[model samples]
Target: MESTQTVPINQKKTDKYPKSVPYIIGNEAAERFSFYGMRSILPTFLVAQFFNPSSNPAMQTMAEAQANEQTHFFVALAYAMPLVGGILADWFFGKYKVILYISLLYCIGHLTLAIYDHDLQGFTFGLVLIAIGAGCIKSCVSANVGDQFDESNQHLMSKVYGWFYFSINAGSVFATLMIPIIYAKYGSAWAFGVPGILMALATFIFWLGRRKYRKVPPSGIQRNNFLFISLYALANVGKKKKGESWLDVAKANFKEESVEGVKAVYRVLMVFAFIPIFWAMWDQNLSEWVLQAAKMDRTVFGIELLPEQVQTVNPMFLLSLIPVFTYIIYPFFDKLGLKTTPLRRIGTGLFLTACSFVIIALIQEQIDNGGSPTIWWQILAYFLLSAAEVLVSITGLEYAYTHSPKAMKSTMSAIWLLTVAVGNIFVSLVNSSIANKGFFAQLEGATYFWFFVGLMMAFLLVFMLVSGRIKERSFIVNEAEA
Candidate 1:
């Protein structure tokens, strides 16, 4: 007897991306401008503008340290909230609706900053809201970009992700450059208010694409989610009665289709385990690096630069490098028979990040010795860091999108974002530990930057080893449309 089974139909191949991609890109540009603009000045704002000089001397004495700590805490919370946001999108509201609702909250958060720039109470509330709003949308927005294509147009995924990152840098470059000028010249209200306006525009642009988007609805209640499969695997770990592996025993609890999905999620999670350490180094470009800039002379060609404005270098370098790598450098390497695998690119990125910190450590040494290093040294550091970002951060997005099962793409994106959260948390903990312990007082200077370099180097070796051990697998197989 012969048995019949249903085969999944493949989407038709298309050379062009969806028309709605522009709307999403526009939304991202504006939203990133809003986010990075507000954040660009936050460390300075908390230390300078937010607190009144009339406050206690103790508060004034601790201002800089408090500002750094608060900045990381805020960023950590923002990244952490993606976990909840991802769950809500996957289990209930779907990506589009969740993004829409959260964007509104995001707008409100920015407005609160504009309205309450001087009031610590209102400012703190605004940051909290922004954290919630931004964190939630972070997962959905990236996954939404992936939802627009199937196997047919999937070849464009890497290019699209590159452009997506380009849009991010475009906005960030504008914000990091302009917002500081607005804050310095017009005061905090106009600076924060400008971002609010941009955020509102971002929300509207996202909404404009509603009809054109390919909506992936929630998975609804299912027995094969990661949580269930994980629990099942743990419960049956030693209870395998036959020759079945523990994973096979877990698979017995789900339909055939679900087994593959669970395996993909598990594999991706394994990759994610070591990623936070990379982010721990990357996110400092906004926090500690900016603080370092505050102590340096920030003038070039007779135009004085704000400490935060130094960050504009990152986006500027990214804007230039993304294309160079995509069109030239990567292809050259490929033609030379050195195909840059995702894991390899990520590992290379990790090493570059460590190198950037080494530069920072050297610069810090100059500063500690009472020598003023040129801001150009920091520019060089940003150059290396931006290249690292192009390799690691963008590739991670592409990897998450490509590897995730259709039902769990947003969840996987959330997991990727969670790495950033964990990294920020690590920064916060390190800051606190340094503050409390005199034994590690050396952490306050060049030694601290060197420590991260060594730490990242260690992780790079571990990442490469693990990447070699894991077999590459694709959960979805494309078939020509009938």
Candidate 2:
């Protein structure tokens, strides 16, 4: 049990951070290294398993397309499971416990990948385990980071989450740079095995901080969570109290605060609805972008870069840009009489994403014309994409935490992650659709890139118009900072 000295974040009395903060940061770095290390090589490994790259040109094309589809499918499934993870942590096991326990399962998943390096069935089974294990802890980790402080240190929450994201990219940078080299030199088993070791180390680092942690115990097996109470309100609809709201019907069976919280979540979900379009463009970095790199001239300054190595710059850019945005760009914009509000920042990011895809589409056009574009073109695209990600992903995470009901932050974080799944599902569907013979099935290369560019621009226009309708409210966390 955590010390009785631990209190809910909303009730904290000090501006200083709790001891658990560094441990969370450390664990995140190691865990990201492990996750990305494995993921960075997943596409290459899948393609090798399914078909030889040295095969017929048409066969290679089909193989690459299928590999991209399966990769996104795995990504979608991994992200989708966070809802279940959120429910578990919010209603059964506490965040700390759930994270620790599932982390062990995550290690097992990595080990399975290493052991069954050449077996498709076993490798897929490992992906399922890893997806669930990774997905389950994702909500708990993000929410648990917030739960460490109350209003006393709420202002620091933003800085901490910044660091949280930094650690993620830090690890990703290391893995993306190193793992591909490992895969090239040592082959599949060692490439996957190395990440498994990092995961175990991540687990140990988390466990070491257990005693000093400010743990939030779960709301144990009660019929009082968001789902149950929302259903209760629906059943009791039209039986409302005279002066109360529609949701107040559930006040007979539950608390008024709980019902209002759900309403707030619903409103936030409206803003969230348009975000999948942004993600559809952003996550293509791993799928479509990597494949695009393979066809480009990797030589820059006489040093030939590996296709995967080109993406390492993304994390590197993020590392520098996050601080630049926080300390320079945003402050400069604010001084110039422009309010860099979260919604506005997100809108700018969406526009930038569309711009990046324009560059990508142009590159695809070159590739289709049998020209190998310089890797520098793709690098420039990644810069725009990275900047866009800093705004959309980081700002969105902080928004999800601060704007939603305090009671279900884990669930809210899970909801945010589910948007990624939704976006990837769209990509996967499009990927599979191309495999069939249809009008659009003939669409590949630059044509495919233009399709997403148009899609994103349409969504960006919609998001800009609708996001203004979202009524954002600040909670105890970071209230003073605003």
Candidate 3:
């Protein structure tokens, strides 16, 4: 049965991508700009507005730490709720319809934040709505893009994924620079309102391409199973013992033996397992790491910059690095017979992330000795982290779509995001530990650094051991053709 359907389903149709892809990409770019713009200043705003930290120096410290914990919890829920949205998109509303519905809710979230800036209960409510709405929209939009192409134009998948990530960073870069400046000048009301406007624009742009999109109808088939295969793979802590491949277990349970899609599904899930640690660190941008930067000097050429403004460095570095990595680095490596596969890049990213933490630890020790660390150290750290992000975050996005079954592509994308949710849960644990306990009592202002460093070391060791045993399944359809 699988063999009969495989050729027809995967057969090449049209070689040209619908010209409307650029409109969708434009919409995503503006939407991301708005989201990151508001988010970039959230930690700083929480301390100053809700906590009233300025009156007391210690309160400032306490507020910053509390904000970190809240940020992690909020981001975790925001990323996690996408699975619920994905279920709805798969089983009920189709992807494009789901995106349209949720985008309005996202706009509402931004409005609430702008209007009720000082009301704690109101703000919390708004954040919850935004998280749910954003999660819903986030999962569906990317999957909607995949639905636009058939086997003939599927060769462009890599380019589409590349442009998708490029747009994200482009939006984020604009927001990072402009939002900080806006937050400093106009305060939270206008800063928050900006994203609402951009989100509205994004909605309009998505609609513009509605006619050109290849609408993949929702498959109503419901298959219930108890296990999450990614977690199951992670449960095997050590090397793959003889005849002990996780794929074997997956194959045994997957009754549809002829459908190679099931085999591909399990393989992707196992690779997905490697990314939890990377996300755990990636989220620190707005949480603990942002707090760390706040304590550092941010002056540039005699002009003092806001701490949040420094966050721009990552996106700026990313804008430059993406071209280098894609055009120069990838081509050079391909020529040398070097394996720069997505999974390998992700592993390398995890190690680079560990190195970022090491730099943080060293800088903290300097601050402990009554030495003011240069702003360049933070800039340097962002560069390293950005490089790591190029590998893990972008690769994860592409990997999620390629490996997902056609029937539940958006759902699987949400599951890939679930890894980020799990990572955020771990981050919350680390942040809460640092804030509430005396575990690193000797580190003083350096407690945050020490805590993260410990986590990174453990992640590096675990990633090294597991990445090797993981099997590769080709999903980039062009690899064979090229």
Q: Give the winner by TM-score.
A: 2
RMSD of 2: 4.7
* CA lDDT for candidate 3: 0.74
Clashes of 3: 0
lDDT of 3 by residue, 309-372 (tens): 7888887888888889999987899899996977778877887887787787787778767687
Per lDDT, the best of the predicted structures is 2
- Per-residue lDDT of candidate 1, residues 193-306 (tens digit): 999999999999999999999999998766777678768888888877687656667767776556666677778777777788888888899978887897787788888789
Off by over 4 Å in 3: 1-22, 150-163, 207-214, 224-254, 258-271, 301-303, 327-344, 395-412, 436-444, 473-482
Give the winner by TM-score: 1 or 2. Answer: 2
Between which residue pairs do clashes occur in model 3? Answer: none
Error of 2 at 417 (Å): 1.1
| Candidates by TM-score, descending order | 2, 1, 3
* Model 2 per-residue lDDT tens digits across residues 246-283: 77787788777777777777777887887888887788
User: TM-score of predicted model 2?
Assistant: 0.87
Task: Evaluate all candidate structures by whole-model CA lDDT and list the values in order.
Answer: 0.84, 0.84, 0.74
